[model samples]
Target: MNIYSWNVNGIRAIQKKGFVEWVLKEDPDILCVQETKAQIEQLEEKLTQIDGYKSYFFSAEKKGYSGVAVYTKIEPLNIRNMDIKEFDFEGRYMELEYKDFNLINCYFPNSQSEGKRLDYKLRFNTAIMKRCNELVDLGKNIILCGDLNVAHREIDLTNPKKNEKNPGYLPEERDWMTKFLECGYIDTFRYLQPEETKYSWWSYRFKSREKNIGWRIDYHIVNESFVNNIEDAVILNDVMGSDHCPVVLRVSVE
Candidate 1:
């Protein structure tokens, strides 16, 4: 099964950039998108009615702000939000329970300049980790993927030294990621290609994409028990629509 995750930045905005066409061509078994920035009613039929894929959208209470979606050729057995009111209102997290595993698509809130929202972001991180552990304790495999809004290590970004005090690369954010991975979850891309420097998200300023000045913030993280089934994890920097490209996880379901 080929599962792809992307931070589309904005669903309507990307539609003008051939987002639908790209989806048809790439044809992943499952596509989890973050930062949809649109409600179901606000979208046109074309986006909601893509061929051969059933789409599920959970939009934020706020208009055109934070939202997430999943387009799957294989319909999930169950779909649910994390149900934590503070986090739920942002439309950040969802669970697509398949026969054997739960697929979570999440958009971590950006800890704005000088870590203004660092406390809130850290709480969200802890909540997610707790949810993952609870499922794992029940023998559930998890495929957690999306824009984590973090670059776990120095190698995950282009200029780690320059970005050390920045929002996404703050020491607190990196420490949480380290702690998350230590709690029975695996960062698939790093686990698969330890030394590769490919990135999924780039800054729109300073010709960042052109200069390859980017950070690998988007990810496909799975539980350690699911590692054996993870065939490959990749940062699809070649594909583009938003500031972030797609991260792919290929696995064997059978």
Candidate 2:
């Protein structure tokens, strides 16, 4: 199965920039989207009615904010949103249960400059870890993907030293990620290409993409036991509609 994930920034904006055409061409078995920034009612039929796929979306009550979606060729047994009210209010999480595993597409909250939203983001981080543990306790393997909003290690972003105190690269956030992985989840891209220095998201300012000064904050993470099922993990920098590019996880799972 080829499962893909991308942070579209704004679904509406991308639609006008060849998003539909790109989806048609890639045709992944499942596509997980983050930062949809649109409510269900606002979505054009072209997006929801994409051929051979069933689409599910979770939008923020505030509208045009944080949101997520899943377009799958294989129907899920059920779809779910994180029940935690504080986080759910922002439409940050979704779980799609299939026979083989649970797929989670999440758009983590940005901490912002000077750690403005740091407290809230940290709380959400804890909640996600708990959720992952709950599923594991129930004997479910998970394929978690999306923009996590943190660079786990210095190698994950350009000039890590210069970005040390930045929100995405903050000590607290990086420590949380380390703790998350240590709890039995594996980062697919890092597991497959340990030495690769590719990035997924770039800044719109300072011509970041042109200079390749980007961060590997987006990911396809899975339970350690499911790691063997992955055939390849890739950062599809060539495919773009937003500041972030799509990530591909080729795995031998239903």
Candidate 3:
């Protein structure tokens, strides 16, 4: 099935910028959205018209803040909002359990402009990884997607040297990502296109998108067991609704 993920920045803003049309064109069987920044009530009228998909949204308690949503063609057996103690308050994770696997959409904490939130981000990462391991131990396949907000390697960002001290490229952040991958998860896109310099997120400043100076912070990571079934992993670099573009993965399942 074709599964896609995008951090829309703000669902309302993108919906005005033809996000609906873009979704129709892509025709993914499932779409996971991060940074929605709006509650279901606010998007009721606009998204209700989208056909052939069942939608589930988890909004932060704080208005206009972090949130996530999932739209799927196949009806999920169960949809759950992760209660990761401190992290769940921001509505960062939503999981859909199908007959064969669990699909998780997450909007990881951004360290913020001053790096004051780095500690919290790290803690969240640890907790989430633990949660993922718990699921994998159950022998169920896992598809984890969203704006992980960290550049895994120097190659994942435009200028690694200059960005060493940057929030997303900081050594601590990158190390956490390494730990995640080492825990038997496959970074799907990198697995398929290792030499490609493509990126999913761009800075809104300095004409980053125009120059293609960006970071590959978003991802679709699956457990190692499903690696052989991965058909294609792609970045929709041409599409624009937010500073981030969409990342997609197609995998085969019996």
Q: Please, what are the lDDT tens digits per residue for candidate 3 over residues 148-189?
A: 999898789899999888789888898998989998999999
- Poorly placed runs, candidate 2 (over 4 Å): none
Better of 1 and 3 by TM-score: 1
Those runs of model 1 whose alpha carbons end farther than 4 Å from true positions after fitting are: none
TM-score of each: 0.99, 0.98, 0.97
- Model 2 C-alpha lDDT per residue in residues 69-158, reported as the tens digit of each score: 999999999889889999999999999999999999999999999999999999999999999999998999999999999999988999
How does candidate 1 score on lDDT?
A: 0.94
Model 1 C-alpha lDDT per residue in residues 24-134, reported as the tens digit of each score: 999999999999999999999999989999999999999989999999999999999989999999999989999868999999999999888999999999999999999
Supply candidate 3's per-residue lDDT for 65: 95
Q: What is the C-alpha lDDT of each candidate?
A: 0.94, 0.94, 0.90
* Candidate 3 colliding pairs: none
1 against 3, candidate with superior lDDT:
1
